[model samples]
Target: MTKVINIQPVTRIEGHARIAIHLDDDGNVNDAFLHIMSLRGFEKFIEGRPAEEVPRIVNRICGICPWMHHLSSNKAVDGCFGVTPTPTGHKLRELCQTMAHINDKILHFFSLQLPISFSGRIVILRFGMSLESLKRRLNLQPRL
Candidate 1:
């Protein structure tokens, strides 16, 4: 006989996923596959837009990583322009991206992990304060 363990709707990731662990005849875990259920066609959508529009267009791919997408698209557009950003622009972009990642990490850690770590109403306040402060500092304009 075979057994399977499925974990659906995995939390705290960029998107939804279903993880299935296959079991051997004795029911021990043997294999696993992570299925991404939130796949989108952003590539196709951006294919024909003007190079200048690429950044804004691709930024809509996901609310979780719009900064990454925007940065990537900006790089691609810069390549098309046959010019690279100046050292100052590069530094500013890096700073903004770093801030975005820090904000995202804090949100994930607080909302997902802190609840299990601290069981109290204060956790909610902490999460809210952290998120709000990060949002203000990063100027994270939502794309979704």
Candidate 2:
């Protein structure tokens, strides 16, 4: 017999979602799927908006990766306007994007990867360290 296990409202995520894992007769994994249930309709919302304002509006689409959305929307607007950022501006944008990438990696590592990797065990720190303390111990300066 085959069975399907559904995990709904996946924890620690910003939106509603679920994962379905299928098992075959041998009880081994056979297939899986992820279902995302929320719809923001950003496209319909952004229609008829000024190009300059779209970037700001769309940035709210994803709380976890807002910078990526903002920067991408800015690029699209620039293309529509045939506007090329100066060399300095381009470098600054790239720097911010890189920083966002690093920030995301650090966040995911601590929030998602570490717990799973540790088999959901609570790793105690010597002095009841928090994430801030861990970052400080690692010599990571806050980006902004």
Candidate 3:
């Protein structure tokens, strides 16, 4: 006989998903796959869009797709219109985008580096292990 196993709303992701598994006659697992149920219509939302809205729309989508879609799209629109953004306008937008992306970079740095630092201290306290041993366990370096 065949069977269906369903898991709904899987965790640790931005959206909802479902996982399904199929089982064969002997009760051994046969196959499995994940399915995403949410669609934000991002493509449709962008079609026929005013160029000025690109930044705002892309900013809404996810973490970071186009870093400065608004400013970039505005520049493209300026090209299409055969005009230039004033030095002041361009610089201001650039500054704003740069600041936003920098903040994101700082957050990423902490997310990536802070845990490694703290984890080493934690391991040292708990197990009194050496860096070489930890590295070996993590497969980051060969055994000494």
Question: Which candidate leads the pack in lDDT?
Answer: 2
lDDT of 3 by residue, 57-92 (tens): 766655543456556666767886799878998788
Pick the TM-score winner: 1
- TM-score quality measure for candidate 2: 0.71
Clashing residue pairs in candidate 2 are: none
> How much does candidate 1 score in TM-score?
0.73
- Where is the poorest 10-residue window by lDDT in model 1? 116-125
- What is the C-alpha lDDT profile of model 2 across 6-92, one tens digit per residue? 999797666789999999999899999999989999999999999999999999998988999999999999999999999999999
| Model 2 ranges off by over 4 Å | 1-3, 13-15, 22-32, 119-144
List model 1 lDDT by residue over 18-122, tens digit each.
Answer: 999999998788999999997788867777788998898888777777899899889989989999899999999999899989988877677656553444222
Better of 1 and 3 by TM-score: 1
Q: TM-scores for all candidates?
A: 0.73, 0.71, 0.46
* Backbone clash count, each prediction separately: 0, 0, 1
